[model samples]
Each structure stands twice: as C-alpha cells, then as structure tokens.
Target: MRLLLLPLLFSLFCGSLTAAESVRLTNGEWPPYLGEQLPHKGVASRIVAEAFALQGVEVTWEFHPWARSLQLAERGKRDGSAVWLHSSEREEKFFISDPVVESGYYLFHRKGYSFDWQQIGDLQGRRLVGTRGYDYGAAFQQAEASGQLRVNRVTSDETAFRQLIAGRVDLFPMDKVVGFDMLHQHFSAAERAQLSFHPKPLRSDSLHLLLSREVPGNAELIARFNQGLAQLRESGKVTQYLLEIQQPLSLAP
Candidate 1:
C-alpha cells in the first residue's frame, strides 16, 4: 500500500507541474497591436494571452527592440516572439502559428502631392520612404533591388512620416491602421490633415506568433496556441477584443 501511494503522489505532483508550465515570449513596442501601456498590453497581445490561457498555459511578455525580439526568440533566449511577419528566413528557424491578424500595406503621401500608382512600374523614379529592417513585400523589395524605385530609409515609421511632411521623400508605405495610430499619437491635427493613404494598397499580409524550433517543447506549444486561436475566433472573442480598440475585425481581412 505504501509503494502504491508513493507512486500516486509522484504522479499527482508531475501532473501539477505540467499544468503550471508557462511560456515566455519577446515582444516589441508596436502600439494598437502590442504595447506595454495599452490595455491588456494591446489587442494582439490580449488575443495571444487569452488563446494560450484556453490551452491551460500561461504566457509572459518581455519588451525589446524588434530586431532583438526576433533574435531572442531564434536563439532560444525566449520561447518565442509574440508576433512577427512570416518569412522564409524566419520559417527556417521557427514554428509559426496560424495568423493572428492580417495587415494591409498602403502608400501614404502628403495631401495635394498628386502622387498615385497602379503598379510597381509606376513607382519608377519615385522617392519611396522605407523603414529600416522592414519588409514591404516581394515586389517592392525586388523593385528596390533592381533600382527601379529609390527608397530613403529611416529608422522608424514616425521618422518616415516626418521626412514625408518635410518633403524629403515622395511617398511612404505602411499598415493603414498602424499608420493611423502613429498619426493620432505624433501628428498635430494640422499635420494629420496634410497626409492621406493612397487609394491603392501596396499589399496585405498576415502576422503570426513564431515559436523558435530551437526551444524545447515549442512544437507542442505552437499546436496549443493554434488551437486556442481557432477557438477564440469561433467564440467571437477576437472580434470583441478588436472592438475594444475601436478597430474593426474587417480591417484584418
């Protein structure tokens, strides 16, 4: 009886240990998506947290610079990154979750600038503002590579917009919602009035949570996260979370 009881107690302890397992993810200060000050750490962070909660796992986030965030995840310093764009290079080292949100890229120019483009070819000879370390898309990247488009690279989106307002660049491309968030935060009403997003969006892509393959148990973690995300979508929680930020679920499409 003592032997049997000892085995049962050990099993219970192991089960509790499993139940208390948690994951730590690195995140960058991307507002309206993921931020330290925003409610529940912003929409995307809330979604990721709740989804993992549903899987009986807890998650904690540490803020870092975007490049460092990816590096930490990739090197197994953290279990994963809270969110990032899926790329072939990233895919090589990480297990990417189902997309948490879709992002659209649009060209923003100063109002009255009369700039418009229907295709990449139309961008020839144009001065495009690009953020350092950001990937716009294959077409835009290829165009920049071939010298079809000249880009003035800046360190951040805010800097890019400042350059645009200063007439330093012809146009800039950014996520519509993210660009608006920046406008709300940094630009005066007068400055806001001077800017507009082009009617033609450059492209759209989905953002995903990337679990580093180098991290132990990451495969199971990714599977659990994906399952929870699907459940959140079905239950309309994802939509509810977006509405809290006054952003429409439709924006993600």
Candidate 2:
C-alpha cells in the first residue's frame, strides 16, 4: 500500500506541473499589427494568445526590436516570436506555425503622383523606399539590380512613411491594410491627407508565428498551433477579430 501511494503522489505532481506549464513569447513593435500601444493590441499577438489559451498554455510577452526578437528566438532565448514572414532562411532557423494573416506590399506616394506603372521599368528614375530586412518579392529586386528604381531601405514602416512625407523619398512600400491602419492611428489629419496608396500592390505574403528550434517538442507545438488556428478560421473568429481591431480611415476633404 505504501509503494502504491508513493507512485500515485508522483503522478499527481507531474500532472500539476503539466497543468501549470507556461512559455515565454516575444514580438516586435510593429504598429497596427504588433506594437506597444492600445487598440492596436497587435493582431497576431491576440490571435496566437487566444489559440494557446484554449490549449491551457500560458505565455508571457516581451517586446524587442524585430531583428533582436528573431535573434533571440533563433538562439533559443525565447519560446517563440510572433508575426514573421515565412522565408527559406527563416525556415532553416525556426519552427514556423500556420499562417496567421495575409498581407500585401503596396506602393505609397504623395497624393498628386500619377499611379501608372505598367512594368518595372516604369519605376525607373523614381526614388523608392522600403523597409529593410523585408522581401518585396523578386520583381522589385530585379528592378533594383537593373537600376530601374532608386531604392532607400529603412528599418521600420514608420520610418519609411516619414521619409516619404518629408520628401526624402518619392515612393515607399507598405502592407495595404497595415499602412491604412498606421495612417489612421498615428498620422494627424493633415499628414494623412498628403499621402496616398497606389492602386497596384507589389506582392502578397503570409505571416506566421515562429518558434525557436531549441524549444522542446517544437514541431509538436507548431502542429498544435496549426490545429488551433484551423479551428479559429473555421469558426470565422479569426477574420472577425481582425476586423474588430482594424480601424479604417475616412479620407478628409
């Protein structure tokens, strides 16, 4: 009876430990999508948190620079990173979760510039700015190589937008939805009035949650996350959550 009781107590302790397990999550300050502010609660953060909660997994969030966050995750310093673009390089370094959101890159310019780019060559002689460390797809890369476009690469979307507004650059690349949200949330009415998004978007990409390769059972964790995400999508909760936090701007006259 004493031996049996000891085994039962150990099993109970293991169960308690599993029940209270938690993981540390990290993300960058990307406004409208992920940021250190209100209302913007970071769309990817919210979705991933909700999904993990359903699995009884608790997470603590740390905010760091985008590059630093990825670095930490890759080095096994953090459990996972949020809102990452899936890429071959990243895949080799981290375990990626199911895509959480779809976003496209668009060209933004001063309101008066004509939006007529039939080909990459059309952008030649025009100054363009884009976020550094982002892949705007192969076409833009080809244009840059051919000297068809003058490119200025900045570290953040806000920096790119500010550069365009300050006349430091002629055009900037941004995600259409995120660009609109930033304009609505951060830009003053006057500043927003001076900016406009081109009708043609440059590239479309999916965003995913990335886990550190060092995390125990990383593949299993990503599989669980994907399963949860699928359920959220099927229930339409994912789209609804996106819309709820997305504040659209009304163009001022």
Candidate 3:
C-alpha cells in the first residue's frame, strides 16, 4: 500500500509539472498589437492566447520594456512573445510563429509640411526621427550607414510624434496602424487637426510570435497556434473580436 501511494503521488507531481511547463507568453506595450490599455486584448495577443488555449494549454502573460521582453524570450527566460515583426536577424535567434498581423511603415508629419520622397536619396539632407531600436528596413539602414539620412532616435513613439509637431524633426517613420492609434489616443482634436499621415507605405511586414530557442517543444506550440488562428479566421471570430475591441477613432476614414 505504501509503494502504491508513492507512485500515485509521483504521477500527480509529474502531471502538475507538465501543466506548469506549458506555454507562458511575454509581451510589451505595442498598441493594437499588445499594450497596457486593453491588456491582452490586442489582435495578435488574443490570437496567440486562444490558439494555445484551444490546445488545452494555459498561457500566462508578463509585460516588460519591449527590448527587455525580447531578451527574455531570446534567453528562454520566458516562453515567447507576440507581435514581433519577422526578420532574418531575429530568425537567427528565435523561432517565429505564423503571421498574426500585418502593418505598414509610413511617414508622419505636421499638416503643413510638404515633404515627398520616392527614394532614400530624396531624403539626402533631411533629418528623420524614429523610435529607439526600431528597424525601418534595409533602405533606411543603408541610408543611415552612408550618412545620407540623418536619423534621430527617441525613447518612445510619443516623443517622435511630439517632436514632429514641435518642428524639432523633419520626418518620422512609424507603423501606420499604430501611428494612427497613438494619434487618436494621445492627441487632442485640435492637435490632430494639424497632423497628416502619408498614404505611401515605406514597407509592409507581417507580425509574428517569437519563441526562444530554449523553450522546449516550441515547434508543437507554434503549430497549435497556427491551427487555432486558422480556426478563428474560418469561424469569423477573429474579425469579430477585432471589431469589439476596435476604438471608434481607429475606424475613422
């Protein structure tokens, strides 16, 4: 009887351990993707969460600075992160899930500015501002390296927007969806009246979930997430959820 009881206890302990070792997600503030206001309400966040949930896996979310969160994911200190733009550089360090969102980079400026640049060379003498640690794709990187584009890095998107408004910077590059969201949330009606977003997209990329190399069974987790997302899309639940959380201002034409 004693030996039988020990085996039962050990089996229970292993089951608990397996449950605890399931999916755990790390993320940071990235509006319309993952952020504080809506908590885990962002499109990418919900998709990833629901995907894992469908697999009978429980997920826990922890927020940190974006860079720090990525570091956590990279080191396997956390299981994964949502809403990361897929990149080769990142691919080298992490396994990326199927695209959960698509966003385009755009040029934002004060309403009165009349800047037009079809190519990097067109901005040879102009100063551009962008969020710290953000990649504007290869063109901008080459321009920066050749000293053709003067770049200013700010700590946050808000700061870049503010500097543009204050005429402290010539141009700022940001994700069109996120930029519009921020503009609606942070700018007063009067302030918004003085700003404009260009129709031209600098670059478009799909956002994905990034898993650390050390997270055991990440391939299985990613496959499950993809399956879940496909189901959500087929059922129209993804669109419905996005509509439910979508801000009125974000729907503006």
Candidate 4:
C-alpha cells in the first residue's frame, strides 16, 4: 500500500507543479474534422487538445467564420487558429505546426454531367463554383488566375452545393468528408443523389495548426505542440481517431 501511494503521490506532486498551462484558439465549422457541435468538438479538435495535453498545456476554443477565425488569430486577439492549408503568406505571419490532418479536396458535381479529370487543365471550359476565401490549392489558383478555368465564387458551402444540384454550376470542389457531411445534413435524399464528387482529388493537402507570431511565447508553444503531436502520431491515436470520425460521398443512387 505504501509503495503504491509513493508512486501516486509523486505523480500528483509533479502534476500540481506543472498545472494550468492553456491556450485559446479560433476554429471554424468544418465538421467531422473540426466543428462546434460534433463530438469532442470533432476529431481534429480532440487530436489538438490531446497533443497540447501531452505537452502539459490545455486548450480552449472559440468558434467563428473561417475568415473571422483567421482575422482574430492574425491580430493576436486569439493565440492562434487551427486546420488550415499553409501558404508562404501565412508562414510569414504565424508559427505553423507539422501536418495536423490529411485532407483531400474533390470536385463535387451533379450526376450525368459526364465529368472526369486527370489534370487541372481538364477542367477548362467547365463552369465551377467555389466558396469565397477558401484555398483549394496552387494549381487551382493558377488555373483560375490564368483563365484556364472559370469559377463563380459564392459566400458559403451550402450555396456552392445548391448551385451544383440546381444545375446552375457544373462543379464545386470541397473537402470529401465535409461535402458528404453537409449533404447528409442539408440536402434531401434526392438532392444528395443528384450530386457526386470525382474520385480524383484537386490536391492532397495536409491541414495544419497556426500559432500567431504576434503572440509572445507562441513560437515555443508551437514547438511544444509539434513534439506532442509527434508523440500522438507514434501512439497511433491519430489514425484511430480519424477512422472513428468515418467516411465520404459517392454519386450512386
């Protein structure tokens, strides 16, 4: 009994000495990945929280529009934000973490549109809708900029999907899991049946955590987060957590 108590007491003593380190991060509604309503605030949130815990830090989250989340974090109004595709502009502003999640952006389109594409150029001459301010990828941006592809930018994901189903647009690219989750939540069985995503991904992108450089100690914090993340990966919790969040959409009805 004394031997067991000795180990427990030591653990408690060390834990008390290093308690209460916490961070506030801005997040958005990108469900099954990160959302305000999903279990454990969704899987990515759970991984992030657990990673921080491994480093003896705690996390508190604030939900906002994706753009608003970036704005607040960039201004240092929050410590940082989560789950973004990295760009050089972002790298200049924040201390970015190692890959937090594996994400794929597939082009969603209506059935019977006869769509298939092996390259970005294959999308030329097709009408596409994209959510304003979302980054699809460099190839996508270059195609859009050079006029090889024309896209109608909408303000929200629902609008984009609605446009596709209504035949107002030929295609919309979205995260595979997110697109299906949205379909399951917002569309009728028939409406969902009309939409399908091409199996080929626009870009296989890894989402990341961004720690604002404007916030003091965030540089070190990011390092700690990365270390903790590595530990989590080695433990296979990341893979297990992902599978539990589950699967995607196909246009077969």
- Total clashing residue pairs per candidate? 0, 0, 0, 0
Winner by lDDT between candidate 2 and candidate 1: 1
Q: Which has the better lDDT: candidate 1, or candidate 3?
A: 1
lDDT of 1 by residue, 39-107 (tens): 888789899999999998898889988889989999998999978888899889999999998788999
Better of 3 and 4 by lDDT: 4
Best candidate according to lDDT:
4
- Model 2's alpha-carbon lDDT is 0.81
Question: Alpha-carbon error at 182 in model 2, in Å?
Answer: 2.5
- List lDDT for all candidates, in order: 0.87, 0.81, 0.79, 0.90
Task: Give me the overall lDDT of model 3.
Answer: 0.79
lDDT of 4 at 103: 88
lDDT of 2 by residue, 1-253 (tens): 9999999999999999877857688887766678767453577788887787766677788888878888899999898899888989988988898889888887889888776785677888788888777777798897786777778888778888888888888888888777877777777889888988777878888899999888788788888888878877888888997787654544352
lDDT of 3 by residue, 114-178 (tens): 78878878877776898878889899888887888889888999999889888888888888778
TM-score of 2: 0.84
Top candidate on TM-score is 1
